[model samples]
Target: MTLTGHSLIAGEAVAGTEGRAFGINPSTNEQLEPAYGLVSTEQLRAATAAAADAFKPFSSLEPVRHARFLETIADNIEAIGDELIERASAETGLGAERLRGERARTTGQLRLFADVVRRGDFRGVRIDPALPDRTPLPRADIRLRQIPLGPVAVFGASNFPLAFSVAGGDTASAFAAGCPVIVKAHNAHPGTSELVGQAISRAVRDLELHPGVFSLVYGAGTSIGQELVADPAIKAVGFTGSRAGGTALMRTAAARPEPIPVYAEMSSINPVYVLPGAVRGDADALARQYVASVTGSSGQLCTSPGLLFVPAGEDGDRLADAVARALTGQAGQTMLTEGIASAWQQGFRSVESAAEVELLARGQAGTTANAPAPAIFSSNLDVFTGNRVLHEEIFGAASLIVRYKNVEDLAEATDLLEGQLTASVQATEEDYASAAALIPVLERKVGRIIINGWPTGVEVGHAMVHGGPYPATSAPSTTSVGTLAIHRFLRPVSYQNFPQELLPAPLQDANPWQVNRLVDGEAEIQPR
Candidate 1:
């Protein structure tokens, strides 16, 4: 199927003059289409400047109106569901079924942000009333609410092209907070991004949003990215990619005269632990479940279980055998891009070269460019503890099995883990008792802890935590999932000593416009 390609700037399809860049099909190693032009540095500057200007009026819009705009965008995304899936599959080499699910995630996220805006959750508004008659001194009445941070620079992620690209959570959350967006399209699937950009552009027109509210730019190399993040107009950045890529952008943001927040979720191993009782009772069952985790989406996820900790014994060996057998006949899967495939191959080789580990099952390398085979390895706790190299993430269908001599060794291993998005435990009652001492340490190391379950299926709910320290994400306290994600796009401001007539409608006297807030000394919306 033919796909159209263009950049959306100021609600129009603006073509770039730079040389073309090609998007290839990973499944067949075929060229999917002719190259598209990279957005010139001039275009990048213009897009950011436009967004900066757009933020002035957009951020001041009434909360209800902004919420309506978000609702409209969500509807528009849902209306074009089929087109998004088809283009995303064709452009990114993902299967149609997988793309369909991603489309839902993408639109669902947009709608979730709409709910957040309507509920004023991101506002986080608080009021502290004056006590003029109190002792000490007359206290001042102060009202506080979150304000939009301004224009945002979003770097699209390669995986989940539909959900993490142009119209993904980062862009959606920014818009929901009333900040304009300048998206740097991912090179792996520019065609899919263009289609989504068009839909967003339509939403902007239908909602009568500012022309410069959103802009799409395509950058082929380091120069475009550097320019995007370094610009002063960009109040913040959102990125999901390799550690190296995220770090580079963070450094750029830091070096700027006025530094901005960079929300970058680089990589994680998403480790899992299996206690002695569980390994002894049903090592085979646990191994089968884990095999599915390592091979899910060919293990091309940030939450993929890269490390497995097990008690060393006859049972542990039996579980290792089970895992080896399960992985033995598994077929390879299509990776997101050639760069990722190459990186996965290199990362796998690095683990195999480690003196601390032993390879249990070696997956066959693919003859084609996109396919990634499954790989499994085994090692002792001492070896892994002594070597920091064993802790890094390998972004592919691979798992490293670590055998601990005792519960103490398991505790030590848990203590050594860096911050992660999720950690799982496979434990029976006896095993749970044995590892109960380590739960606190594990809790500190990851955002979420699971029992007898995989970590890849992240639920998009109010309680979900998708961020962790350092490598997992630059901002550990903030999530890139759920309505809370909008917090990244806002900062709190307090208004004091202002007349009722001068105050914003949300905080005006007589309880006009009936929204929830602390009025006078009480929490009520009734008329004064």
Candidate 2:
């Protein structure tokens, strides 16, 4: 499984004439080989055209074979083994242990989607029988089931190269929904993208699926990416990147003749609120955990707690001091790319220069090229609420702390904030009264609420939500993680007065797919 600089298009290794770019090792600032070839307009169109050609067969694949296809992708990715991990580590500065876990997540996501396909619940079946003799006007027989969108264009994220890249959640969900996919490999890790792209290609070959079911292309700049979204063949998009980047894609999709939906996870300043009783419970330990979450992955994670609220009193002072000490002992690690490190520095300086903010603590710098020192700042509720710059995400190992005089001030501060992926609350039983009052406010502003915990690690499961309103993600009704993400690529179709022989398998009277259905407003249970 050697790395090639070519793009994988419809099961073919297509060399790009557009341009070439190399993945750089952020830890050492060294160029990695071989230089990846960027796709031309012609090549990009070829991939999408292939995808459109594949949608008919790929979307209609039988349940058993479709599930096996996903499983085979996981097996092929595991077969790549150490070479995959080593290449990903070099391309991105993430540690080996972390990449190993991410690799498992990537494979686990594919396997999870495989299970979803086998169950066939994603088809979302419903039926209403004809009422022939009940009334003057007979009701017509109707059935409904979800169908796949034609094709999807997925943009990789810079932070999680494995779990958010080529064979990540977006691709897995789209495949589970039975849509073909075209992935635009993130520029920061082309070599890593190539490896995973090859694994998916192998899976397509092994299962004898349509060749265009999956395609991975490289882009030298924004032109190729924007063109992908504007292409008529692509019906929807899955994107995880900067807010600006996500919005740009959104605009392109909207400007198209046939506007499409762009499911983009842009930015978040996941906030943490520390109730008075909880601050009194274990200030020292809470401060340490807070700093740990801030500095994890050099604070590049989207869910990192960017803002923290503490009670204003003697107990709060003790907690603030603990936070300072904890931050001072911490150190930053190598970031994913030089560009990301540069942006983090710029954002940190802007927040540090604000007159209302006071520097609480600054940590030691890492012993690498792109790694920078971590820092924390402090202010009051008035300053945080009044200053718009203070409310923005710094996108690095920097955080801001604001003290509130009472529960009313805390609730007001929470109300003023923008949409977030998560909001964490540290509270004891004694503080539940105050914490309970703020729950509705948090429900309006964030997607997930955490009690007595941090917001760094995201669990991949059926009920987990990795999305939110507005700035957190473009689509408030959808999630970019877990099993529910499959709905992003599905659209419901209703059949009325149709013959039983013409009905799709899932909507058929006999339930040939063995999927559960809602029949005449009643549950029609089926064996798993």
- Which one is best on TM-score? 2
Q: Residue-wise lDDT of candidate 2 within 1-528, one digit each (tens)?
A: 877899999999999898898999999999988988999999999999999999999998999999999999999999999999999999888899999999999999899999999888889898999888767788889899999998999999999998988999999999999999999999999989999999999999999988999999999537999999999999999999899999999999999999999999989999999988898878789989999999998998999999999988899999999999998877779989999999989988998899878999999899998899998999999989999999898888999999988887787888888899999999899988998899999999888999999999998889999998889999989999999999999999999999989999898888888888899999888876
TM-score each candidate. Answer: 0.95, 0.99
Model 1 misplaced regions, further than 4 Å = 1-3, 364-368, 510-514, 518-528
Q: lDDT for every model?
A: 0.81, 0.92
Q: TM-score of model 2 relative to the true fold?
A: 0.99
Go through the candidates in order and give the clash count of each: 0, 0
Q: Candidate 1: deviation at residue 102, Å?
A: 0.9
What TM-score quantifies how close candidate 1 is to the native fold? 0.95
Q: In candidate 2, where is summed lDDT lowest over 10 consecutive residues? A: 407-416
